[model samples]
Target: MRDLPVLTGDAVADAATDWPIAEHRVLGRGRLNTFVSDTVVTPDGATMVRDYLTHTGAVGVIALDEQERVVVVRQYRHPVGFKLIEPPAGLLDADGESWLTAAQRELAEEARLRADDWRTLVDYMTSPGCLQESIRVFLARGLADAPRPEGFVLEGEEADMEVCLVPLDDLVAAVFAGRVQNPTLVVGVLAAHAALRSGREADLRAPDAPWDARGAKAARDQELGELEAP
Candidate 1:
């Protein structure tokens, strides 16, 4: 049997630790801001500067059709300079939105899809080494084609986006073959495939579940800002 996590208050505190930020500075600002320097001090007097991006987190949806196929969108990422296929995902920090609401909006906007059933599939950090971004994947079934939100226009690369419906088995093959490598897409597809293969629904977290790290990190950053105020 797998070891269960400790759910005590102290254990929870330890699990959601907010590292002491000795100093913090913003290097640049944009839609997603950058924290160019953050001095972290440990209890043992060790200190280090961590340069990482600050994100509001995001959500991805794996919309499944009645035929057991999943929808994917193709768009170009300028930073990577490669066209990538991924599930419909949107930022959580947008306008102080909830995770479920963001996922639902992204589903409609990206894939022109609506679903009757939804469940949490997996939650992941895209790049832990240098990014503070986390994305929660949701499995959405009972899908039907729908019109995009009124007066909401797709812009830039999204304006030319392409959508495709691929069988879950084939998608798993592509994921294993590295043909479809978007983290959210790969994780969501493989997880949904595994769950369906086992003929059982995976135990899922509540859609509005609280994410400790996102808020805890922000609070830590806020405390540092307060200390720096003069």
Candidate 2:
């Protein structure tokens, strides 16, 4: 049997430290144009270089229809080169857009539906080792047909995207069977199924749940205005 470690600790506990970014450089930029490389000094004073993507964050919605079916969309992801089945999701690029608002917009744009009840299922960082993208998943229920947000035209893969209403359990089975492979969809379906089976709706967070690590460091850096001499 393979050895595994079971970690048990107080999640609410954290250690405080003022880490320093000794140096920074812009390697290049792409469609998400921004400076995204860095050199920093560890607390122990060791120098290290790192590169990461900068994002404004994102949201995914697990939209449930009247029959308790989940909304699934099949779209092509260029980088991964896969036509993955996924839930409605989008980047939080709109100025001053709150997380819940972004989730609502993405749901409306991709699924063309709105919900009567919304709860935050989970918030996580995608590929934290090399990406600075923070994502939140929301559980949306009481869905009904609606028009897409104004001027939100679908183009490219999104224009030709295929959407289907899938039974929640069937979607969960597809996730486990390697048929549905999008990160957001897998996480969401498994979570939603477990929550529904366990009757743990009371444990769900409100739509406005605080995301502490959602670019708080960048905001803090902007406030501190250079913590140490260059």
Stretches of candidate 1 off by over 4 Å are: 1-14, 200-202, 224-230
lDDT of 1 by residue, 1-230 (tens): 99987687665543566567777877776776555578899878899888887677888998888888889999998888889988888887667677888898899999888888888887778786677787889999889888898887999999989999988889999988888878898899988987888865656666766677677657865775686578
Could you estimate the TM-score for every candidate?
A: 0.87, 0.88
lDDT of 2 by residue, 1-230 (tens): 99986656775443334457676665666786344566778878898887876666789999988787999889999989999889999988888888899998888899888899999997777777677677899999988888999998999999989889999989978877888788899889888898889998778999998777665746734633453326
Highest TM-score scorer? 2
lDDT of 2 at 221: 43
* Candidate 1 TM-score, true structure as reference: 0.87
Q: Model 1 lDDT vs. the true structure?
A: 0.82
What's the distance in Å from true for residue 155, model 1? 0.6
